[model samples]
Target chain A: MKIETLFIDRAIRPCEEIDYIIQSTSLEPEYVENSKVVYDHVNLSDDPITKGKQTLYITENHGAVIKKCPGTSHYTCCDYTILHTGTFCTMDCSYCILQAYFHPPLLQYFVGQHKIDAALDEIFKENKTFRVGTGEFTDSLIWDKISNQPAKLVRKFADQARARSRSSNNNFSILELKTKTVNIDSLKDIDHNRKTVVAWSLNTPKVIKSEERGTASLSARLKAAKECERWGYRVAFHFDPIVIYQGCEEDYKEVIKSIFEGVRVDKNVDSSSDGVIKQSLGILPESIVWISIGTFRFMPQLKQIIENRFPKSTIAYGEFITGLDNKMRYFKPLRIKIYQKIVSFIRQYAPDVLIYFCMEDEEVWQKTIGFFPKKEGQLGAMLDRSVMERCKAC
Target chain B: MLNLQTTISNSALLKKRVKQVCLDAIDLSDESFKISSDNLFFSGNKSSSDNSLSNLTNLSNLALSIRLTGLINPIVLREIDDKYIVVSGFKRVSAMRSIGMRETPASILSHLDFDKDKTYDFRFYEVQSALIAISDNAFSRQLNVMEQARGVRLLKRFCSSYDIAQNSPAIFNVNMGESLINMLDDIANMPLSLHELIESDKLSMSSALKFKQYGYDKSLIESFATLFSKIKCSLSKQKEIITNIHEIAAREEISASDLIESKEISQILDSQSDNCSSNVNDENQKANLIRSILFNRRYPNLFKAKERFSNNLKMLNLNSGMKSDIKLDPPADFEGRDYTITLKFSTVEELAKKANILSALTKNPLFGDITD
Candidate 1:
């Protein structure tokens, strides 16, 4: 398990033989000598098309696949499907638990296409109506560089005509590849109907630069999301782990404002079955186009785990209290204020787009939205159920 | 014994008599019943022995009662010695009695005598009362999800066919709501021993609810309930057990149910009857159990010990600023010295409290054995 080093800059250095040209992180050691040392080659593979072992560090989580849906947690907004890709983020956000969520904390992509295809086939065959996403463990589209990205997933989904038809409704969507990066080149020409939501994990620019290292600028990611929307692809944006810092109001306000400016909300939301208000204006007819907003939340115990594992995390230090589920609760007033500002701003522009919160409690939900969902899974499930019902009637 | 069972259906007649007695004007009498007022007012007892002479005083702080002032409240009658026992008062009659009269006119009917053979034998009534005593006040006060579910199920079954004005669904709905609320408390109040049943696969919510159903067998259920509660509280306190929802459920099964249910196998299956109403309250109760444990970390003893230590620390006149510098000497009985050094308190108050409590334990025999 001896570690090796190679400086992988554009020019070959005779003195240094490094495996990777370590990109944007404060993680580089002067003399990297551990088995877990990350090889940071900008180009790991000689042939771009032929998939090499992704520089993305991946470990097979042979752990039980049937996990207690984290979506059941009130704070959790997004329904997780499967983590097709593993820990492979170029960004080194201080608060990102993926630093500790993965051991050896390297950017490795697992090329287990065969396993994934079989898994998806089984998932599609068994479930008539399921809302799943691959962005659980890894950024869904971040691995587009190493693998074919969601396009392969899109192709597989397009092939599932029988499965789609048998679903009794068109509520079936394959991959909601959420990302903070502006890499939509791979997604530009996919069949628009092949349920792939190219999601963006947007944060305030202050957070992005200070915390998220090697990630795209906020404008670039939004522009890319806008492009995907224009190309007839339904898009989603996530303000997850939205850091509640001073001036977060202005920061989040700008993000909401920019989103409406780039992505035409009216046209895209006009056709949505959910009748969600468009936070922006003028887009194609789509179903339930929206944004999921949430302040940073995690288990109280996860704080220690993060500190022990990823010691340099700065994002874990905002004031937190124990929530109802007894996980660390962000100050309610602070969270509510942020949510109110964000929702108001969103309502001002993309008033018709569905705006929801993830992993938030009933109290928070009721405060943010006018009412709380009837049942726990009802909110997320209702959107897909209504969409499916409408498509079936048609 | 004048039989009143035939008249049980005539709730209206019972109500009228209750109203007449309650409304009859009389002056307040002193210390009429031998039983304690606390027992009579709050002790959810249904029957009392005739000759036992409980000096139970009726509640006399009467202004206008809400029920009587608004409308007639129904009164339940128990037959006693050819006389009717008003389980609760029609407000008007109770008001007259409080106004000071001895034997203000009563609606006489026979008290409930489940065992007619022992009629007029006050011993039988006392024995029956003891048999019917639903819960032991000495045991742990709060019930966990499983325990509360069993208690509610038992009460529901016992009261379902009772001659209450409401039907089963109506009663079930009310009780189910209560159970749902208590279920959250159960999670909040679950002992660490039971947490193993929760955190591990040993106990499932379905099974835990079953345990709650069988809690009617108070002697058996109470013992296990106390044991599991302690286990749950202890696990959370010790920080030894997993607090995850599935894990807590599983662990609870292992420590609480698996071992106990096998011994009481018949009761376990019997309690898991499908006849129970699957209403919103019951469903939410069960859900809250899972949800609470999953989201909330259940280190049961931590807070209690921390509270105790904080109380002890408060005795010292030490300022808040001087808190962190205080050092604690470990007790002689304490097992690992490494624990003394490495133990990190969640807050400065916790550190200060622990330090003060430990330092004050110098006279204790276990003080020498303290770790680190």
Candidate 2:
């Protein structure tokens, strides 16, 4: 890969000395000579980077060392945690918020691994079983196109934690590099435990093909996820930005069907056998993949921004109304309808696996997941609590 | 869920002029008048694309409210492309529509609300041009001091551009554009109670206008907002703090930042930690002891605890698992509190299975009646 030179904004060009491989090899001298590069080196900056269909911004969030996300926003379906590697995506979804989030936006990767490391150290020292991922700001693995940075980070995390384990022993989760790209070959070589859950963002076939651009095909992404699962790595799937198109019901059904075909789950062993029959021979039918669905949602102002930025795109002009946060978008009934369909499908196919929504409220959690947390983080606590109860009973 | 049947009755409420008027008569050709029926109307949806119904729901609910009060607070509208556009009162329109009314009365006005010194209008002829620069089905722009100040200034500028009826109240006398802007700024800064008070007409302008300079933290504002919106409570400084603390505790886990932020609490914890470490040599000794103390117990007690806990948890988890098994129909035993649970036998085998669960419940004292 040849380097390209272009006048990139200073906002994206973080640390001056950084190694980057130019993904596009057809770089002219003019493209490379005048280019300004950005990296992540500063404290979290508020400036947003806006592109054609994407904009990236940063906010200071002090949250759980272990975050809960299967990607169900109260509005959208799946809510998964991204390690907040940086704030901007490389892919261009027509409905992406990045287009309006950043001004004069450029692809900016946060290069301040040291600050991240410090945060991780503080988090790991607490050693309170944390599950974190690094796919929030940007695609988890797209940086691999430039360099296998995530691979390096994961390696560093695994090594440091191992070293610390001998003295101040505490269990620490390394990282889950989630993506919609076929960028897992680099990750395959890295050693990871069940502590790391490699996740992928999936949408209905209609959504992935039409709305999400600059991303891998659904088949390619699923193939990679299946491979990861086959390698004995626990994986996650996100059905996010579940666009409410004309044939969305059928489209989502196909998605769930394909997921089952790809990732096998055993029905009889799931909650006992009456639902799906099993013989004494111990033969069991294949099951579906664990999945999470997030209804389509954006920040309150994002709809207006999308309207302001991509007025031609009908994705924003769907059936919507004002929600609790007062952003002008979708109506609740439609959202519930979409959510109910997706949940039922996931339940029917992948009966045993964990399924959840991203960023949803308590009511949706109860309605969809069938259990309300006594409090907010109780959803995550429930899983742990159940496991502990089961093991300790033995 | 707020019970649909439990909704407050409005039979005694007098309909406002806005609700009596026709929507078509009000000319909704202007793009702003036509709202897409997207899922954003519901609350707490994070997608920027989703519209928060706060403004819409508030406006409609306000209409329902004004109807109760026998008042018609005029909503400002603007003329765009020869059609009257509603810059506000979107909720009022929806509320009116919900009641099967066609038209609602509105106050016609200019759309420009900008700093008195500056003026620029974003044109929207074809819809596509209006959507060119943004994403996130919703808004992410932080309303900073600069934006708020600019809004305040702009409203003042726009107020002078519009006609003021002499009989209008004095609060409405000031640049309403500015008043609205200042009100929003106050809202941005105001405790939620004050916001609710303002929204619900519980707080007068004299009190709410004060919070513009001093901003309450988000929790205080949201709690105040919720109390005022839902419970229609008046906001006070002390109440704001209490409600905010309560709501925060309910929503988020207790964190170190939360513990440390309270200076006295931090001091107390620090002293405690210091006192504890004075007697222990191992760094993790305290943690291990705490863990053991928490987890260590008699096996018999633990076994009993596990059984009880599992049974309780199983009830919770069973709702999801047994959703198919459970029937929505009420039982014929005819006791309201007893909840006569009815089971629709899917097959003969399923009927036998239901009998088994019922028999088991009867057999074990721990298992209550399946028909809660």
Each model's fraction of native contacts: 0.00, 0.00
Q: A243-322, model 2: which lDDT tens digit per residue? A: 87668898888777766665322442234335554322211112122455667766666654554444345565454444
Give the C-alpha miss distance for residue B324 in model 1, angstroms.
Answer: 33
Chain B TM, per prediction: 0.26, 0.26
Candidate 2 stretches with Cα past 4 Å from truth are A1-17, A22-82, A160-170, A263-290, A304-312, A383-394, B1-372
How accurate locally, in lDDT, is each candidate?
A: 0.48, 0.47
Chain A only: TM-score of every candidate?
0.73, 0.71
lDDT of 2 by residue, B157-235 (tens): 3232122122112222223343455454454444534533443344444444433322335554443344223222233
DockQ of each: 0.01, 0.01
Candidate 2 structure lDDT: 0.47
- Candidate 1 residue B85 Cα shift, in angstroms, is 99
Report the CAPRI category for model 1. Answer: incorrect
